[model samples]
Target: MNLFADMRAVVISALDQMVADGALPEGLDFANVAVEPPRDAAHGDMATNAAMVLAKPAKLKPRDIADALASKLMDDARVALADVAGPGFLNLRLETGVWAGVVQAALEQGSGFGRSDMGAGRKVNVEYVSANPTGPLHVGHTRGAVFGDALASLLDYAGYDVTREYYINDGGAQVDVLARSVYLRYLEAHGQEVAFEDGTYPGDYLVAVGEALKDKVGDAYVDTGEQVWLEEVRDFSTDAMMDLIRADLAALGVEMDVFYSEKSLYGTGQIEAAIADLKGKDLIYRGTLEPPKGKVPEDWEPREQMLFRSTAHGDDVDRPIQKSDGAWTYFAPDIAYHYDKISRGFDELIDVFGADHGGYVKRMKAAVSALSDGRVPVDIKLTQLVRLFKDCAPFKMSKRAGTFVTLRDVVDLVGSDVTRFVMLTRKQDAPLDFDFTKVLEQSKDNPVFYVQYAHARVCSVLRKAQAEGWDMSDAALAQVDVSGNTHEAELKLAAKLAEWPRLVEIAARTNEPHRIAFYLYELAGELHALWNRGNELPELRFMQDTAEASAPKIALARATAIVISAGLGILGVAPAEEMR
Candidate 1:
């Protein structure tokens, strides 16, 4: 039961009545007419711009149309008042019973309270954390992983059929570097001293992979040259590294529905198929690219290369699909991968990339546009860097990942719930600060704990009520009569709860899962504020000596808990029953 939607429907119906009365023109488009919370809460509970948007089209003055619309809207039983505000805005005040109904609906729906059908069951493929299988995931990858997983869950709650995917970068030179590094470790396993050069990975995480290679083949490639063991070790090492990466993702509560291998596109004619699809549309050609502006590579020269006409589809320039040496460029496999996604019949595609890949976004979107003929839309979200801090100082690097902090390191320091929540506390494109000390603090300054504490507090209320022999189970709460409660604080919390369905649609439509986190924080704040008010007014408390007197108040508290669980569920955070 979305009260905002219910109110919007009432507004639209009233507008239709105005059209019948000839106060407004017939067949006017009402798509732009929106009913939402006023900018200043002091204005009214809700405001609609129907008159403002229709003024020019209807050949009427703004205030003139608002005056007529306001009178018609005031007739609805749920609308307490409809006053024409500045220029043309129609501000609405809903009856207190309307907010009371929202609390009752939340208690009835439980965790399914805010689930929406905004997506209409469209299939969406979300590809994220496609890091090279060279080592365990680092802090940067961790942010993308958490963001992507939460997004998938959010879309699912919003009624999108989502598939979580990982595209393995096994066809790159990085994997070959990993192969050579593991080979050196293999030699060390055979009792040979080895020194890791500048380009080789020196992390001790590969030590076990090397030792495992010895157990599997018993030094068959001992003292052998690169040709004898390069390919074999490359495949073996990539698998091991992928296993390590999978484990790291698992520890962070991420599980992918698919792992697409870049190497598969190499020998499988997939790249040719994708390129041919674009070439058929006259988007592929051999061309010379302009030298990058500002700073050109020292070896910069205009060379003829196979290029995709990405400029036709919104990119700055055509991108090279094949290098001058006739080798497939890095962009080739990415094109094939997206083409594969389109062929799978997904209605939409979403890629979660690091901020460094910002330049790559336009080209990837262009490729998908050309492949799907603009039928399937692609949304690429770039997550910015995460700066770690401890005790007000930047956290040190991880020895395991060799260069940056590993995902496990952050998760180990705080927890998976805190890591995920803190990672999403900011917009994806904005840089985030992950302070170890601050996140672990049990204070309102910490958003994760604050939201969790609200849930825990609700549970405590229910437990205390139960101890006092007040029946508070779902079945029991359903029997509560909410007709007696009319406190402004209680009504304010119900109003917040009523916004959940609307919030889900807004967050999903923008493809921003962080919005859900932000909304949950606000909702929790309202709930906590209401709970705190009970200390000053005994009548507002959840438990009462008589079940007849307590039912309505406790029912409101139960309803608040229900909405909290639903919001937290979308964020993949467990609603805490008790705070430690």
Candidate 2:
């Protein structure tokens, strides 16, 4: 079903024949040889750098090898013309039936059209949106949530056993502050006014948690000290915050396979076990770190501490695992978390972090590398900030969150589909501007609308055809002969359809789901181009004077819609059936 792969196989078979016939040397490595679309459509349908890459390795001139490969490739039924271009590159023009076959494949495969087996069913863990369980998730976490969710879906489509995970940051000083804040609200629930200090959370979102705590325990801990209720209230506050976080994620249609707690690593001998493994490998040692590079601050005194030889793995410096106070450093728990993941037998690991956590990447990778003895690879993707705008002005609409906009605020404003789609409209490492004005517009400038409109257009055609009493099921449309869909616009769309499988593999290989969004936009543009062309050329319209003449056109449109649905599914966006 993958036309590009099929053609690449054809090219490889022809090259193998060339070698067998003594036209080429015996032991040439074709690993670097690639068959891809040409830079310009006017040149040809596809281009290969087989001759260019092999020229020096084969000890032969580029032109000579290209000329030999061209004649050999022309023998294939799929290659209509194999022209040796310039010095070495070979340009190939495929038969028209090849593009037609791609459209037919789309109709037959439905949403499974672009699914790939590149990962070979390897297990992968993708951890994202691990926001601290102190309050509601903000806009920054929303971007990470959408990015990680889409990436998991993309990996699943690419044949990986993906586990969507969220690491709950509850075992930290922040949750203690949350507990104290909730206690303040608990006092308020008892009809006593309380003031929130600088270190305590003052968000209105915690008021409900306070009221619920009062309902659970009455006024029993009203006059108690920190030791009397700190542990009990900390546990209560964290669970409440997690419940809120889960609801926010569900609002955006995101669900995780695992909600791992950081506190679980403590008091379970896990941290000591992880460090002990590193110690056994001779990676742990007691050492003093160097001082700050530039001007030394007041607290810049160096001290001997327990350290990990992170530099040996790839980090810039060896990292400290324990403080001078003998307590575990923040990095220790993270190391244990990843160690637990490694012991779970995942083939690979992926962490979706925020832009602010960029400094932690190298050390975390080094930890996984050291823990797994370099057998497991970890890819860390950092999502940048998202700036919101409304009416051409900066928008801040979160009174409940007190300081920042919450994920529910954004989702409630536009919708889950628009929120998810707009979040992925940019690269993970690039800053995104989520303008409410532009995203909600019902125009081509809005990518969410434009792509959905294309699907809706196809749905409208299906409805009209069905009302006319003509059978328009996918089985019927797939049976139509689309070889006569030779119009340049129609063929252009089919060519774009042929790139879906290749694009899916590329996006999954690079761990970039934004590529899917970009590809879907381009594919929608092609379909829209064909739809607009039908306005001027009556023959290009889907509804012809007779069902016999219209079947092929309708089949092509339905095929486009099917691929659109598949791409949107990866992005966690519902394909619109009708424009509203």
Candidate 3:
């Protein structure tokens, strides 16, 4: 099904035959030998470095090896022409029948055409959008949510057992701040005047939580001290905020398999257990710390503290695990969380964080490395900021969120499909400018619209064929003789379809789902180009003089739609049957 892989095998088989016939030496490692598309399409359909890589190792001239290999390759039915390019690289032109087979495979497989088994079922835990449960998710978290969810889907398609997770930052000073803020709202609900001071939240979203608290407890905790209501309200308010966050994520089509609470690590001996495991390895120590590189503070002095020898595992410096007063530091709980994940027997781990957390990546990876003793691998991806523009100017912040635009604000304005697709239009590590006016524009300049329009066009073609009383189902179109689809545009589109499986494997291997977005856009361009060509040449049209004659052209259009739907599915965007 993967023509690139199939051709690579053919090349390797020919080289083995060369070794047997004494044209090449025995025991040359073919691991680095690669077969890929030629850099310039004018050169040929495929190119291989088999001759170049083997020349030096085989103690033979590059040109001499290439000549012999070309002769052996021409014997195969798939290779129509094989010739040496430059010094020794072999460029190949596959038979036209090869493209026909690719089109048939796409029709036969439908959306499953590019699914790969490269992961071999390894368990991968993907933790993303672990924003503190202080309020509804904002635009920054939305990018992380979309990126993480799409990555989980891509890994699943590549055969990894992926679990989507969210780590709640509840056991922190931030939650206490949220409780006090909600208490002010609660007092307001009781008809009492209260001011949201500098340290409290003033967002209008918490107004309902305050009113709901009044209904639950009546006047029980009215005018009570912090000792009486802080704990109870903290739990109550955290639950409410999480409900809001969950609803926000649901609006964007993101669902987590697990919502891990940081509070559970405390009073549970988990932090101590993680540290104990490190202690057993002599990585924990009581040592003096050095001053920071810049101008030292006037109150600064060298002090001994409990630290983890993080540098032993790849961190820049030894990190403190506990304060001088013996309370656990912020990094301790994170280490414990990852230790718990390692104990859960996951084979790999991935973390999706906002760009501001770039400095935190090294230490987190070091913690997992030290915890798993290099038995498992962890990759951390950081999503950069999103700048929103509306009406050709900077968009205003949401009054409901108080300081920033919430996830629902973006989704409500442009819809979940547009929001999701546009968020991934740029790389996670690169900043993205999302223009409201431009994204919704019905033109080729808009990537999401371009891709969706291609799918809709295919649907339109199928409908027209069906109304003409032709059988246009996948089973029937798959059986069509597509050898007659020899037009330059038709063959070019089919060649692009042949790249899907290879592209999926590359994107999955690099943990970059944005590549999928880029590929979908390019694939859509091919379909659009071919569709436009049909207008110039009547013979290139999908609907021909007869139904039987129209079968091949319709089959090509249907195959393009199948691949688009599959790519969009991975991105969590529903394909459009018809665009308004």
Candidate 4:
């Protein structure tokens, strides 16, 4: 159960009583009224702005409303103290029984302690790592992959019907270049020396694709023209590249429920159908174009083109769906792709694009809005660049990816766990620096290691307890009475655990999964701090002179581990039972 939500309900009940007694006006909106942790712990356990928010609206004074509300709340046994602060902010200190119940709740709930029903089973499509199927996914794609996968997992934890998806960019001219690159490698595999031109992919990863192509075709397309082999080789090369991409993603703990093909939209009339749908809404138009702002193109000229009226939905300018040459622009396929998602009955769509795609966000949102007639909401999250560091210097590029560090290289160096956790330590829109120097360190400086260490410490406590012939299972710990264990050290940790359910809803609502990583780190810190306190205070320890007496203390430790495991599960990271 959410302690904050429960307290908010108590505050709302008090306000309703005031309205009933004619002390406050009726029909005041409580939607903006919030009950949350007090800014200063010294103030109280929780605070609410119910009085201040309703004072002006109710035509009443702040102090008068706050006093009446506080008096009404004092009748509840759960509320130990309720007093008005500076204005009408109600600062409340809950009874110690309330905090103890949180530990009991965590033990009873196990890893599902913080799972929320905030999403209410809404279907959400999360598309990420939609790199061109020409080669391996690189470091930039790795960040997007981790962010998107973790976000999908987070939303699922918050009760969303989430789908992890990847879009393959095989419908564009880039795939033709990949075909030519594989042809050159195919020629090399046949003992004919071939040089990679400036536009060709020369990464060693393609060598195997070329050899496999030669094995299947066996000189059938060796001396053929472009028309005869372009389609076939492009298909072959894209399949192989996707196979490699899947392996790379698998190594990093990423698995997509859907691998959508851009090519599937090309010949299936899906692109035309989506455009036609928009055309029916009067969103499509043929209009003269203006040159872009600042530096204009050298060949800038006014041309009538098919455009989507994106400006109506908040885009800076109308986006062209078709070019002067009559070929569909890159934006056309994305519109069709999102339209297809809407047709599949997804309530929400989230695109996890690299930071370079920031400029496309408004247009994409506009397309989804027009396609769904504003019935659906689309959120585009941009993952910023990850600058890698090793040996106190910037990391070098990968030979496998030719121009960047491949995802496999990072996973191979530190394993998938470190790579994933470090990738999410920062906000998705903020740049992150992944330093081998810092991440691998076994100290509080390394967030992943620090959090894992806290979990491992709890496991060690349980093992010690079990070895002493004391049962430490969740059921046994959950049965213990936590009211007697009242050290500030223990209660502080319990307070942090109480924030979990509230934090989950906040993160899910904001579509930010990094908040989970950050929260886990703070929770781990509180746990570690409590552990440190035990060294100075003998009674504060998990194990005491008597096994039965120490059960309540052990319950607290186990509850902390339960929440840690639940949080790590959401981030797609494994909780370490023991540190290596």
As for lDDT, the candidate ahead, 1 or 3, is 3
Tens-digit lDDT string for candidate 2 (1-580)? 7788888888888889988998778899888888888999888888999999988978889999999989988888888999987998899998999888998899888888989999999999999999999999999999999999999999999999999999998878888999999999999999998998978888999889999999999999988899999999999999999999999999999999999999999999999999999999999999999987788899788899999999999999999999999999999999999999999999999999999989999999999999999999999999999988997798777557888889998999899999999999999999999999999999889999999999999999999999999998999989999999999999888998999998899899999999999988999999889889999999999999888899999999999999899999999999999998
- Model 4 residue 261 lDDT? 96
Q: Is candidate 1 or candidate 4 better by lDDT?
A: 4
- Cα lDDT tens digits, model 1, 1-580, are 7778888898889889999998898979989898888988777889999988999989999999999888988888988989887898889988887877777777777778888888999999999999999998999999999999999998999999999999999999999999999999999999999999969998888999999999998979998899999999999999999999999999999999999999999989999999999999999999899999999999999999999999999999999999999999999999999999999999999999999999999999999999999999999999999998887898885657677678888888788999999988999999999899999999889999999998898898788877878777877777666766788788777777888888888889898989988988888898788878888988888777787787887788778778878777777788899999
Q: List the residue pairs that clash in candidate 1.
A: none
TM match of model 3 to true structure: 0.98
Candidate 3 segments exceeding 4 Å error: 59-61
- Estimate every model's Cα lDDT from 0 to 1: 0.89, 0.93, 0.93, 0.91
List pairs with backbone clashes in candidate 3: none
Model 4: residues with Cα > 4 Å off, grouped in runs: none
Determine which window of 10 residues in candidate 1 has minimal summed lDDT: 396-405
TM-scores for candidates 1 onward, in order: 0.98, 0.98, 0.98, 0.98
Candidate 1 structure lDDT: 0.89
